[model samples]
Each structure stands twice: as C-alpha cells, then as structure tokens.
Target: MERSFNINSPAEFESISLQIELKNINEFTREMNLNISWQALEPDFNASMKRFGKKVKIPGFRPGKIPRDRLLQQFQPNIEAQFMDDNIQKYYLNGLQEKELVPVNQAEISDVHFHFGEHFSFTAKFEVEPEIVLPKMKRKTLDVQRMKFISDQQDMDVAVDQLRKAHARIETVEDGAQEKDFILCDLQKLDDSGVPIIGKKFEKQLLKVGDGSFTDEQKEKLVGLKPGETARINLPDDREKTSSSPYELMVINVEREILPEVDTDFVKLVNPDLDSVEGFRDEVQNKIGENFDSRSQQSFERELTDAMITKVDPGAPPSMVDNYLSN
Candidate 1:
C-alpha cells in the first residue's frame, strides 16, 4: 500500500489531496484504497493565529504588537503540513474505529508535497480488517427448564399476607423487645481522638430482627435489647471502613408490629382499581404470568446470541487493535 499527500495553503483556504493505492491484498490481509481530500483550511489557520498572537508575547515585540508575517513564521510549525498529516490520520482512524476494523500491516506514505500559499493535499494507504468466514450455524433442539405460571391457592395466600403487612400500622409497645419488632436507635462512630465522624450518627435508625438484611449473629446480639439500652455491634474486621468507624448503636425504643386485617381496605391499598380481595388476587396472578413470560423470552434471545458467537469464533488482528487504541 502506498499514499501521496499534497498539502497547500492558499489566500482563502487550506486544502489537502490524498491518493492511496493497495499494492498487495489476499484472504488474510485486505488492502484498502483510500483517498482523503480536503480544502479551505489556510484562512482558518490565519484567523486562529491572529487571535492567538493578540495574547502571545514574542522577543522584540510587545503583546498584540507582533506583525502577521513574524507570527506566521514563529507559529508556522504549529500549523504546517505535519498538522494536516496529523488531522488526516485522525479522520482515517476515526472511520476505522466506527467500523471496529484492525489493519494488519503498516501504511506506506509516498509523493508527499506541501506548497506554501497553495492548496494542501495528502493520501494514505493501509491494510484493512480481513473478512470473517462465518460458520453455518445449525438450529438444534435443546431442553430448557420452563416454569408454568398458574395462580394457585398458596400463592394467593402469600400475596394476601404481604398486603396485610403493607397496610399494617406501627404501635409503641410498653413491653420488652421481641423478634420481628422494629427498634429505633441512634448510631455513631468515633475516631481514636474521640472525634465523632459525620454520617456515622443515625438519629432514627430502624432495626428489624430476623430480617434477611441482618445476619443471624447480629439478630441474636440485638434480641431482648430494651428501650434506652445502648448495644454496641462490633464492626467486621474485613469489612470496608469509611469515614465512619469504631461504630456503636444506641437503641432508643422498640415498637411492636400490628398487622392490618385482610379486608376490602387492604385489597384497595394493594390495587386502587380493585374493589375486593378476590379481584386483587386475580390481577396479581396475571401480572406474575406476564412478567415470567417476558423474562423467559429475553433469556432465550440471549442464549441464541451466545450460541451464534460461539459458532462463529471471529478472529481479530492485534495491529488493528493497537491502531484503534492509539487513535
């Protein structure tokens, strides 16, 4: 592969003409025939230098007092043929990046020309990503575990219990703490210097015993802790400690769970459109079935894509990858 770059700067424009050719190509390596031509860049460069020269200070010239000719000479390297070469490579690399292409061979440059006060032109020739030979994928029958959605009596009972809990009201208890009871506490952490850390204090921390959010060991330690009782839960040594450390929790009070009665009121709370418990139960069953079916379909599609990629096993060139990253 070979390319020629002709760069020129005119009175009104900066232009580049590129001519690229593929010298060799085969099944493993595809040669690219690229021609990159651009124009009207000189005036933009002149304008940019004019603006930059206003603030730039040069020897023997005060700020904004440098002549255009002097500035042009001083900053010519900054906006010369090499500048266009860099930009051309950028554009070429960007196009290849969009296609996720990897070139196997280095590009060859030839017939590079830069004529001052004339149009700019450049060309680059390089190897392109080889075409993948996709293997024919055969559709195969596979056994998949499928769940049939059916509204059963047990499912309805579980849903009804959840509804009752959602509508439940909290009640202050004068008695001792019990399992599944919520306790409001104040949590804090102090440094070795006895300075309290921010975000360590929780004035109204709610702790629920036997909840999956807490471990069995934590629940055991918290069990039977009464009002105004300060319980210090040790921080896990391996756990990540942030700004808050040396933790301690103070249980202020405990509240008993008062589950609401499962009636029309609970049913209405579960679904505003439902008037009765039976109607809410029916709606829940339908939604569950619909969600299950949607998830199953999505899983099947994902499996199909995985199988296709496995069969194809596409190969990529490392040089192309490096070129893509550099660009």
Candidate 2:
C-alpha cells in the first residue's frame, strides 16, 4: 500500500513508488530487490519511536514520559539500527507475499541503503527448492546370486547322530571296554619284587580310557578287562614324581556309553518339539531352505539399492556436502 504524501515535493515526485523486482539466476536461485519509498517507511519510523518511548528509561522521567527529541538525540544510532532491521524484515515479507515466492533458506541482504528521508533499498539473494526431473525409467533388472540349501541323507544322519549322542545313556560295562570307556579300579603301588606298598594304594579310583594320567601301557591293560580282573601295569609313581613304576590295578567296574534307539520316547526326550525322526529331518531341511531364501532376499535388496543409486546420481548442495565432510 502506497501512502499519500501531503507534500511529496516536485511534480515528478508527487507519487512515490515502492519498487520490487525478482530476478531468477538459475532454477535453484533468485535475487530479490526492494525499493521502499520514504512516504511508506516514515509511518513505520514514527511508530517505532513511539514504541521505544513507551519502554525507554530516563534519569529524571518515568517510562513513556521522556521527550521525543531528547530520546532521539540520546539514542539515535540504536533506534535507527533497530528500525532498519524491522523495516527490512517487513518489506522482505511483503515482497515474498506479492511475488508468491518461497525461499529455501534465510535471504542474504546486500547493497543496503536506508535513512529517514531517503528511499530504502536492498537486494536479497537466496536459493529456492529445485524441481527434480526424474529420468524416464525402463524396466531395470538386477541379478541376484542365490545358494539353495538342500539337506541330503548324509546330513540327516549326522544330525541324528548328534541328537542320539546328546541323549545317550551311560552304564557300567562288565565286558570289553572301547576307546571312550570308564573304569573304577583299585590302584596299588607295588614294590620292585611285586609286594604292595603299605598305605600307597588308591582304593576304587575312577579313570577313563585314554586318560592322560595313565601311560599307554596302563590304558592297553585296562581295555579288555572285566570286574575283578587284575593287571600289573607300569605307571608314573606319585611318590617318585618322575619315574614309571609298576602298579597293581584290580578292576572294580567298567562303564560304557549307550545311545538310545530312534523311538518315540527317545525322540521326545531329545527334542520335545519333534514328533518323529523323519519329521525332525524334514524340519531341518525346511529351516535350511528358509535360511537360504532369506539370504537371497537380502542380497537382492542390496543389489536393487545399488542399481538405483547408479541410475540416479542425485547431487547434494555444496554447503551441505562440505559440512558433512568437515564433521
């Protein structure tokens, strides 16, 4: 809105014009120019002085009572500076409203000219949101490498063996002892002439086949032994701490590991979720297939994302890219 001037001066200046021009330098940038007439800005300046007067404090007067001339004389620079800021913002908003333009960031003001009697003018430059032109996309194909896991009979047998071992029943064997068997025997330290050393006998001592504590000779002697069988074997003497000496081992008991049959009760004991061995094998195969499918899907998604990025190289602003790298 242009204000009417009671005395705007020469006939040529009778009508004051507020000029605003917008120049588009590129698709993303625009320059805004504003030329404010003194007639239009004088009202705002007078209004600002009154507003300052209402809030300013003086030595000998109450609030809102200071003389206008005195207040202007005392704080002319501050008042002018504040009024310039407020007027610039007001005029900038007016320019935006008139042109119907939206800026992406705050406008940067340059070449400012402002005064009480002279015309106010400035140039504001800023970037606007760009119009993204998406490329004409055809059907793009991405290749995915997939590995299908199929459980074979050998894999199923291995799985069943593991389950059977986990639920195996361990019992004492009174006959031949295999590689991983256990034995309870009376171990007596003997003298050179085959007499048991007094108080040097370990009674009912438990040991396992292939136990590192025993020498190879001792393990070999105990493998084919039954209850009440006695073997005079040479082992490391605890008293001597370094040398091998013969000892009498009377086998008290022998133990063996027995795996359960793949029956309903045994399957239930091992896996409460599985009903039968065939069902468990099927479930295992299905799980393997599902895992392979999931991996394939993930690979396909990654390929698709990479392909899209390659197709569309969306560049970011220089300032944003610089800031990101700096941090």
Candidate 3:
C-alpha cells in the first residue's frame, strides 16, 4: 500500500510519502515492510523542536527563546531518539490500519533502518486471527439442552446453613469426637504387619471427621475417638494396586464448630440493611439463583464451543496461545 499526504501545517516542505508492503507468512501470521520518505518526517521534526523549545531551559537564555543551533547542540540526540521511537510505533499502527489487519498479539519489530537525512524503513511480524470455514450442518437446527436453574426452599436452607457454618466459632471439646468435629492428629502410614513405616509420618494435621471423602466406615473409625487415642483408618491409595492402605491416626485435640443462631441479630450482622431473617434469606436465595444462572450460561457456552470445534477445528496461533497463558 502506497500513499502520500501533506502534513497539516502552514510550512510544508513536501508531501509525506509512506509505503507499506504486507506479506502473508502463513494463514495466521503476517509481515509488514514499511518505508517513509525523509520529506514526510522533516515537518514533524521541526514541530517537535518547537514543542521541545517551550520546555527547554538553558543558562543565560530565556526559555523557548534559545537559539535553534545552540538548543540542537545540547539536546539534538535526545530529541531525535524520542522522535524515532514515537514515530516508529505510530507508523506501525498506520500500516495495520492501511491493511485492515487486527493483530492478536504484539508485533515483533526488526531490521529498523533510519538516519537523520535518509528514508526510514522497518519490518514488523505479527499474528492474526485465522479464517474459519464452518462445516455444513448435519441437521437444520442445533439440539442443546438448556438448564433451568430454580432456587427452592431446600436450596435456601442449605445456603443459610453454609452461612451459619462460615460464621461458626471453634470450641475445644472435652468429650469423644462427633461426626462434625475437627481433630488435630498425627498420621503414620502402616505396613501389612501393622507397623509404622519410617519417614511416612505427617504431624500436626487437622482431620475433619465428616469430610466428603470419608466413607461410612471411616466416619465410624473417627467417631468416639477421644484425644490421646489412636484409630486405624484404611484410606484409598492410588499408588498401590491393592486399592487401600492402613494409617494410624493419633488424636491430639478435638474441636467442635459452634454455629451461631440465625435470628434478626445474625441477619443484621450479615447485612446491616436487613432487619429481619426472612429478608436475609430472600437475598441469599437471589444470590444463589444468580450463581446457578451464571454457571448454566458458562456450561452452555463451553458445550456450544466444543460442538462447533468438532466440526470446524480452527487452530489458534502460537503467539495468541502464549499471550493467553502468560496472562
């Protein structure tokens, strides 16, 4: 692409000539070769000098009134460097606009060639979105099962229970462990002979009696186990083909979670505007419904993308993937 335009200024040296040669290195990658004539940049350099002159401070000379030659002698190198850096980025953007290309990643600029009185040239390589050709549909319409999320009273009860648990305090228990108790214990993996394995001990670990992974048998083993007592727990092991391994858990301390009473006071503590427990429950229900709706939408989008990808497998550019992973 080649174009010439005059700088929007009264003192014009000549028309600014800019040429961009775009090349497709691949379906999703492109390289741009840009060249700009010296006449195009001369007016900008003079304008830049005037802009810099207003801010330049010199000894024995008033600001913005210093001799052009004296100012250039002191700050010409710095000014030229800033000018080139700024214009290089500006020209690169211009090239993209001229070619109507949207890069998915930052361009890798190389082979920069510029001098004070000569033409400027540079090369930029960047990644672009790949063209996708969708396959013809086997059916007339897509068959997608839309999930309708309904928040019922049972769901609200569970959400309220979770809130109560979140605000629950831990209290040291004097009796035997219960199903919801947390026990601080030391676990040592045992061999077939019921002997502790060396270097297989974990200390100061808190084990919840009612953890989701705990089976009924495991809960039975944990229940009624008091401090200073040991329980043999058979846990599933992925490393062994035998499927399970035995571990001796020595209880150090038992703690119980004391849930707060859900009343007007608790509702006010949860949200200051709410004066009634019923209002707080309604807010919680609304939030739960919103969360379910968001999750359902995300699931639908993911399933739709997967179904489309099975037909149109448009691969992503490495640079785009790298950028996504880095972020």
lDDT of 2: 0.73
Q: How high is the CA lDDT of each candidate model? A: 0.61, 0.73, 0.80
Off by over 4 Å in 1: 1-17, 20-41, 58-65, 79-90, 93-172, 187-206, 211-218, 240-249, 255-261, 316-327
- Could you give the candidate ranking by lDDT, starting with the highest? 3, 2, 1
Winner of 2 and 3 under TM-score: 3
Q: Give one digit per residue, the lDDT tens place, for model 1 in 222-270.
A: 7888888766564543545433335567788888879877678877777
TM-scores for all candidates: the values are: 0.59, 0.41, 0.56
Best by lDDT: 3
Model 2: per-residue Cα lDDT over 122-215, one tens digit each:
8877766555566787664544444444557776677678878988888987667766788888989889999999998999888788777654
Question: Which pairs of residues clash in candidate 2, taking residues 3 or more apart in a chain or in different chains?
Answer: none
Worst 10 residues of 1 by lDDT: 6-15
Candidate 2, run of 10 with poorest lDDT:
1-10
**Best by the TM-score measure:** 1
